[model samples]
Target: MITTTGLTKVYQSRDREVTALDGVDLHVREGEVYGVIGQSGAGKSSLIRCVNLLERPTSGTVTVAGQDLTALAGRGRRAGAELRRARTRIGMVFQHFNLLDSRTVLDNVELPLEILGVSGQARTRKAKELLDLVGLAEKAKSYPGQLSGGQKQRVGIARALAGDPQVLLSDEATSALDPETTRSILQLLRDLNQQLGLTVLLITHEMDVVKTVCDSAALMQRGRIVESGTVGELLATPGSELAHELFPVGGTASGPDRTVVDVTFHGESASRPVISQLSRTYNIDISILGAAMDTVGGKQIGRMRIELPGRFEENVVPIGFLREQGLQAEVVDGDPAPKTPAGAPAATAGPAGTTAVPEQTAPPVKEAAK
Candidate 1:
């Protein structure tokens, strides 16, 4: 469990001060893979470091395992024996697999135990078990210089688990590896989260990485959490900046005469016969422009971009029918409605750079019940 209230980090030079984090708040439940995602300089790394007090916050409070991090901000170097004991349960893995070139794989894994004052026989046994756990049992005798990128990271993971941490911090752990290797490492992290019940904080810039492993994710911009929710929930959010970043729907626009609507469906409605209903009820020719399907937290989910023939004015009935089916539909293109809905502005341009027909304003809604 980790909680941060208005967590902030500021850095200073002679000329000026820059705020990396500004009143950020985070709440991670036990045994969940909570992800923090953003582009470079979004304060993602700074937030992760502040978790275990690796980076001292300029303001705000951080509480982990009941220890107040803000109270110990300036005392990181002198966090004392009790603080050190607490930190032993929080393991951190870096982007660069920080393995000593001179040390053997087994020795690298043994480093954390050594720092913890773990003795000879028990340390060796624990180190060997961890190496085996990471699928590098034979690599124990090999030095860090001999392993590939993936092997090196496996060693780093093994070392992080040396203290049997209750929480694991992965700071762009797969950024240095290729796609295939990244998949394997993420799979390993997911497996460990489930099997060992270890709470994991996965920080990355790649939406695919978060999509592959994170159950819930937060989008950070300007050191603040702009969006936070389950991956499916975020994906279903209409006009959400985070959703667009995760699933970029930009592509060639349809002919000027056509009408485009981005239909988002999740849960029971995802597999329902809504697409057919549109054709049967309205009897309009429809063409699917693009579609993507994925499982979020082991639930089947799918979203499709569909286009209707003729003009937006003629497609009004079909769009309303989709809404009744528990789907989110937006008029992505074509002429504005004859009249704008009360309190709703005229539609703007969509990713395809085509005119988006304005719609009657509707409040946000949750996913359909199971």
Candidate 2:
């Protein structure tokens, strides 16, 4: 388990001070894979580095596994021996595989143990076991250049685990690889988390990574966590920006007078035919504008945008009916029209002077859950 209270990190520049983290309070539960997702320059990297005291916070406290890491990290440019010993319990995997070209795969894994004064035979035995754990036992004699990107990362993972850490910190570990490799790496992290009961705190900009392996997630913006919760809680929230970003359902009402509503379905509701039931029960025709569906943590989740035949006032009963069916339905007022391509023909007006726009395709959803 990990907890950070009022964590703040400020960088000193010649001209101005840059605040990477601003009074952030974060908590990661034991044995849970927690994800921090944000765009570049959102302080994700700074926060993770601060967790291990690689970048000491300007202020606040960091507690990991019931130990106050911030207290152990005294005010000094270099870490003392006690702090160094404490860091062995926290493992870190980098985006770029930080393996030495001069060292073989087994040697790379043994580096950490060697630093801890592990004997030669013991280090070799531990490194080989780790190599086998990461499915790179046959590559022990190969150099870094001889391995693929994914293999090199496996070596990095084995090296990190040499310390037998209780917590694993991943800093964009899959960003450099291709999509297939990324998926494989994510799966490996999930496997490691379950197999070793590792408390994983990974920071990434990719929503697919969070959806795939995170038990809970926090969204960072401008060095602040704007939203944090379980994936199901986010999807069920009526106006959650993270939910909209995760499953982007894009569409607009063909006419301004029509009632447009956004609906979210999760858990048991996701498998039910709620839309058809709403249509048949109310004896009203429903036009689906767009929808996105995916599985997270082995549960199906979906978001949909639909249009009704009347104004918002007239569709109140139907919307209430949808809510009764365990759906998060909210009216979208004054839905913006879809933007046309430059020099493209304009949409023609339909009957009753309403512009007719074709349905927009929903964004692709990655089926990342195992």
User: Native-vs-model 1 lDDT?
Assistant: 0.80
- The residue-level lDDT of candidate 2 at 99 comes to 96
Candidate 2 yields a Cα-based lDDT of 0.85
**Candidate with the greatest TM-score versus the true structure:** 2
True lDDT of residue 181, candidate 2: 89
Models 1 onward score TM values of 0.86, 0.89
RMSD of each: 5.0, 9.7
Cα lDDT tens digits for candidate 1, 1-370: 8899998899997899989999998988888898999989999999999888878788888888777856754564675555677788898999998899988999999988999899989999999999888899999999988999999999999999999999999999999999999999999999999989999998999987887899889999988998887777787666666666765564334777667777777778877888986775566678888877776666666667788886666565566667667776766644443334454456654444333444443222221111
What digit string (tens of lDDT, one per residue) describes model 2 on residues 1-370? 9999999999999999999999989999999999999999999999999999999999999999998888878756564676888889999999999999999999999999999999999999999999999999999999999999999999999999999999999999999999998989889889999999999999999999988899999999989998898888887765677888898887877886787878889989999998997777667889999999988999888899899987765665566667667887766656453344454344433322123332222122222111
